[model samples]
Target: MEEQQKKEDGLLNKEETDTLHVDQILRALNPRGRYQILHILLVLLGIPSAGFQLLSNVFIAKRVPHRCAGPPDGSGWSDIFGDTGNLTIVQGRCKLLLTDNSSVVDSAPCVYGHQYKMPENASVISQFDLVCDMDWLARLSQSMVIAGQGVGVVINTFLSDRFGRKTVLVSTSFCLLGCGLAVAYAPNAIVFVVLKFLIGGFQQGILVSKATLFVELLPVEYRSVQSWLSGCTWGFSMMLFAFIAFCFRLRSLFFQTYENDSFMDESLRWLIANGKMKQAQKVIRRIARMNKRSETTILQQIQEKLVLRKENGAEDSERPHKLVGQESCQRLSLLDVLKVKRLLFNSVCLWFCW
Candidate 1:
């Protein structure tokens, strides 16, 4: 009877260890070190560029000086209109009056088109003449870019979950760079808005992936401070956007090089989550070597943890009914949350916030 009790106790211990193996591996890895800092910085480089691209429409859709098109000398407005207190040359900049005192002039939009008086700078507004009656197009263009960002957030998050974060990050970076170049040379408003939308989408993907990569590389204790610091990049990018857009016109070209050239490795947590344990183990060893720690110690801990799980699986075969019951309890679906009133209320609130 004593031997039977000892055997039952050992089986329960094995079950507990098997369920908590991933957590144990995470705890075993020293997540805080020089390697963590380096990974954070490398991933963070793409963020400011994303911000710059996001706010770039502000500069591209800038309002410039404009007036009614046609020669000012040949127009009869000079004879009919005079420089009165209320009636001046500037007042009729875009329109001309038939009689100043009568107030019976036929109002008309810019006849030929509108003449823009911008400085020696080219933008989407100047290139396409999105002024006067077409001013709303500028606002619409900006809105489309923002809408693209929302779409990107949902799609990219889903892709990251399925295809892994590294794959989505690299693909989106190139897409953004290519689309931005297309925006610079767009022949019409339709093409420009389409390209801008795509740029906004890809930009969001990079932003989410960068943050994900940074947080995963950090230790639990340092995550709060690290996240706070990372958030500051947005503000930095706003200021940098002005300099890059005004002084340097090749911001997208720079982004292309920055993203594609980085020789960074994928996240170890991601590798493990995807069931690529061999790749994860290699990454762990590499991280340990970079941090000047003993790789043997890390590898040994991982092997021992894995062996314990295998042993637990062999013993679990004897208790099929218990295993099936545990599996059913552990597997939860979205509908299960709605069955619980408290969980359903929290989920509704979370959806609204999102």
Candidate 2:
């Protein structure tokens, strides 16, 4: 009886080892299959839009040469202010020299609105009359975009952790599209700034979620290659953005919308870690099908692993509930970094470098 029991235990251990080998399954499916290539390409489509949005203010808030409107009757500058003494050209841009009824030349603000050398709708500086006293609004708008990105990083990180990465990525992408379109047709400065803030937020969220998904999709050995590929894609996108901005100017903002059709599956590691075995199995099957591999074999292995895990989970359930609950409650916060001296020093150095 003792010899028979030993043989059965050995066989069970061998079966567990065979079924729980994740790397072996990955090798069998071929990590560098057509599905991975296509997925990477599709995810990269959003990089150019991100670059365009980041640098768009350089064109959208561009300063154009302008002077005060002469008169409603289409009078020229020389015709309106005749025989004026030499004034600084810079002063002439904001303040207009006016000859009152007493023949005394006095400087006044651009009372009748400004006339721009370029198209009236060329930039926010000209379109919304943001020059002279209102020029600060243009700078504020640009600053607001950067501020929104900071705020987005925090909020989106939390949301991505709570919800899945794919869900946040798709939602943020659509939100970004809507914000970009709305900004193009904003009626006033307040509305424009508000939309820009939201745009910055959504843009950051998309970036973070996509990056996490991209890394998760790849194997450990190819992560370095993945980083290089991502860097190259981003660099190329930025260069393309520069050319597009040159050719299309502010109109390019409207053309910047590129829809992502292929939604990526959730991270398999995340699903397994969270005990979502059914969802993990579905993702595995989909991956196998896309890679043109035998889904039945991989699914069988995963199903066996799932059964073993469930058996172990049942045994673990009665052991210790209080310790697990307490550990879960002690969540890490940003302030925790300061608790470690070495970590705090490294963080400060990285901040300065950035």
Candidate 3:
């Protein structure tokens, strides 16, 4: 009788009960509130880091050009002047507009300033020029940094369905980091372009998985708009990147590069989504400590979700699943869709209707 009661009781253990409480709250306060919270959190997460990254880049140029170059020239002026020089690289857009100048009009095949600039003092092989070509091609390269991010979004959407969220995130993260590093150190312009493309592809996969995983874990009401809002964060994130890019000029990879001022930002969300919950907890604890706040154990949160999902799954799958009228309806086979008679009839009908 006790066992029967235990099984029959709807009340769950500590975890499930807490989850139930949260569900009740979700149901009580409109889902809109939670989505707002989610959006706020995402924006909060994306903006500050982006700002820091930007400001840090500026600081690197102004305060620490030595960090990029081997040593400071004992004069602090280069650091200040570096910011002024960095502008030429980011805002220039002559590269994309006129692709074939020779065939078309006054346009000529534009290359980077670093590529063909002839040095006055050096011989044919040794001559160098610091002046960038400032053509449409360079403009396209500038646009690609943000365009690549959008590509990441599209790529992630498809991959999430095929390869599961966690796997895609980790694999893509590793790939992005590798490609990004390669981009930072590519030997030539061609190699740099290839690496940048790879970085964009991998980044897209990572973002999709991140979005899917977050939505899956979020409460249902929070899931709807929050999903779309998360996407909005990416747009906002681009602005953030632009800010950072403006500040953090990438003129030279090793000798000079912008710093990302993400002040102690070990993204716990990234760690948790990647199955590094222990590390996440450590991060949470550290944050709590730094802020002089109390830390909440997520273990209970996990246990509750597990029980709730398991119970829901048991309730769903225990009974034989069935197809409804729309689902059960036979889809027209390809043969039916492409039948010659059907095509002719449709064409004739279209002609008559038109």
- Top TM-score: which candidate number? 2
TM-score of each: 0.73, 0.78, 0.40
Cα error of candidate 2 at position 101, Å: 19
- The TM-score-based order of candidates, best leading, equals 2, 1, 3
The superposed Cα distance between candidate 1 and the true structure at residue 305, in angstroms, equals 5.7
Give lDDT tens digits, candidate 3, residues 87-108.
2211122331222323322222
Writing each residue's lDDT as its tens digit, candidate 1 over 148-221 gives 99899878977776676777888898888788777766778888888888988998888777777776665456
lDDT of 3: 0.42
Model 3 worst lDDT window (10 residues): 62-71
Best by lDDT, which number? 2
Q: With candidate 3 superimposed using the best TM-score fit, by how many Å does residue 251's alpha carbon deviate from the native?
A: 4.0
Q: Let me know the TM-score candidate 2 reaches against the reference structure.
A: 0.78
Give the per-residue lDDT of model 2 (tens digit) for 124-219.
788899988989889888788989999998899778766777888899988888888888878988888898888889889988888887777776
Runs in model 3 with CA error above 4 Å?
Answer: 1-158, 224-232, 252-354
What TM-score does candidate 3 reach? 0.40
lDDT of 2 at 20: 49
**Lowest summed-lDDT stretch of 10 residues in model 1?**
6-15
